[model samples]
Target chain A: MDISAVNALPYEDFVNIFGNVVEKCPLVSAAVWTRRPFVSLADLEAAINQFIDALPESGKEGILRCHPDLAGRDLHRGALTRESRQEQAGAGLDALRSDEASRVSRLNEEYKRRFGFPFVVCARAHDKASILRELSERCGNERAAERARGIQEVKKICRLRLQDLVRSDNKL
Target chain B: MDISAVNALPYEDFVNIFGNVVEKCPLVSAAVWTRRPFVSLADLEAAINQFIDALPESGKEGILRCHPDLAGRDLHRGALTRESRQEQAGAGLDALRSDEASRVSRLNEEYKRRFGFPFVVCARAHDKASILRELSERCGNERAAERARGIQEVKKICRLRLQDLVRSDNKL
Candidate 1:
């Protein structure tokens, strides 16, 4: 759909299409719908980012918590949301070797144990190797900084999802 | 796949195919793989059900917790697992009127708050109206009984999924 199409959506249809742009956080889409009549896809994304930025720490954590662990049990069980499954598969997470999967699983468990939420990464932007490297390095960071980093990844993911959903009208 | 094809699968392939028969509980699939060389579809289902039955209370609740709320935010967001999306859509959950959607959302929240897990009836078995009715009725039960009832529904869901995957072999 184009910018005009996006701008014309009813609240329900808008929320339905964009609700998961933030990966399981529909309220973000719902809130951003009020800022509609977007000039371009970028404007819609900005509204979403602004809403995310204005959230309290607890709310940000809640958003991060909604994400499934990359290549974790959910993937194994085929239980990930469709977007997540595709993203993880794109990152080569679905094909992890036994040893690699074991290592990732161990790191994921430890990361959650330390941070009180699963490690959040934009799998679409990283191959499994880089994902593992970042996960290991980030494990040593303090909680607050890691939360910020994770939310930034969430925005990156949101941007990619938005790009998929809304065609930018370059003619505008 | 037929019963013979199912019986011939490697552990990894087997798990990949049937892991979600229990909805985010790959452990059940992993455990049941040990009993393979299933004589028929019924035998394969029996193995899966036995694995679920063997779980302690917490494990069963854990399985229930893995399910998304029926016609809740995930559905609106298009974030449901593929199987769940199809089952919910088959139940006409995709077309709920605004008021029905709101009622389901409210009942879902209350059910979770009361039981500590989302209300999980197999969407394949009921249309939207019956789902709402059950959600209302089941809310009055104690946690223990609710957990058991939810698991039974999980088994019914598993049976349907298994039927889809493996054709029954009527001949010996």
Candidate 2:
């Protein structure tokens, strides 16, 4: 919908629209209700960014901690969100050969261990091989630097999810 | 100092130790050679974690693009070897008001757009705030999930660097 259309949404309706974008974080969406009728997708994303930026380190960490590992344990258990399921499948993550799958699985564990969080990247852009490569390389990132990268990745997912739910002529 | 006492080495020898860390990337170390042995560092990070996974698409792209985007374009202007300068300037990236730094400076870009690159959880190890938090959340990945994430943010930087790099460690 156009920014004008969004301004017209009722509070609950607006939150409902964006709440889905961040998955479990309805509070972020709810909090953003005060900033209505954004001028562009950038405006909407910016508002979301501001709210997240202002959050306590723990709150932000809470947000970062919200994501799963790439080709992670959650994937095998069928625990992924509907959006996540499609995204992972988009990258051929579900079709991994046994050896490939296990390597990715191991990387996930080692990443989380090294970084104090799961290894993250924008998996949709690459493939099983690239994702695994990133997992290993990023193991070298400083914790603080990696965390910054994590939040950025999550927001990307939200933006894509937002594009799915809303339309825009302005750049996203 | 010979290899045993890496600490005592004159500058030229020190660079030799880590120059081998990334194979075929002589520029990485020949550039780093000016810097000497890092005495305070722990044992060298394992080499296995340095291998790029079999990302046919990205691998092809990697061949095309060649160098990693160290802090993005910053690598090009005599900054690749300036590791010490960057390590000292923490939080500056987090505070970026301009989009350029954020857009080109993402780790995702540095990693995919450089590769080396791997999880399980004890599952019972962390809480929902940390776990489901991890699961549905990491879906925002730009692994190319990062690129997708990055393009969103890059568009953001390019829109503001889309969104500045997310600075956290849950996985992205």
Best by DockQ: 1
**Candidate topping lDDT:** 1
User: Model 2 over residues B1-172: C-alpha lDDT tens digits?
Assistant: 2323544543223333333233222222222222334332221221111122211232212211322232333333544333212321332332334554554335333343232210111122343234334433433454545323322221111211111111221212
**lDDT by residue for model 1 (B1-172), tens:** 6788887765546656776777755546655665667888899888777766754454566567667789887888998887899999999999999999888888887887787677999888888889999999999999999989998999999999888766543311
Q: What CAPRI grade goes to candidate 2?
A: incorrect
Name the DockQ score for candidate 1: 0.03
Per-residue lDDT, model 2, residue B8, is 52
Runs with alpha carbons beyond 4 Å of true place in candidate 1: A168-172, B1-172
Name the runs in model 2 displaced over 4 angstroms: A168-172, B1-172
- Per-prediction DockQ: 0.03, 0.01
Report the error of model 2 at residue A83, Å.
1.3
Task: Give interface RMSD, per candidate.
Answer: 14.1, 18.6
Top candidate, metric TM-score: 1
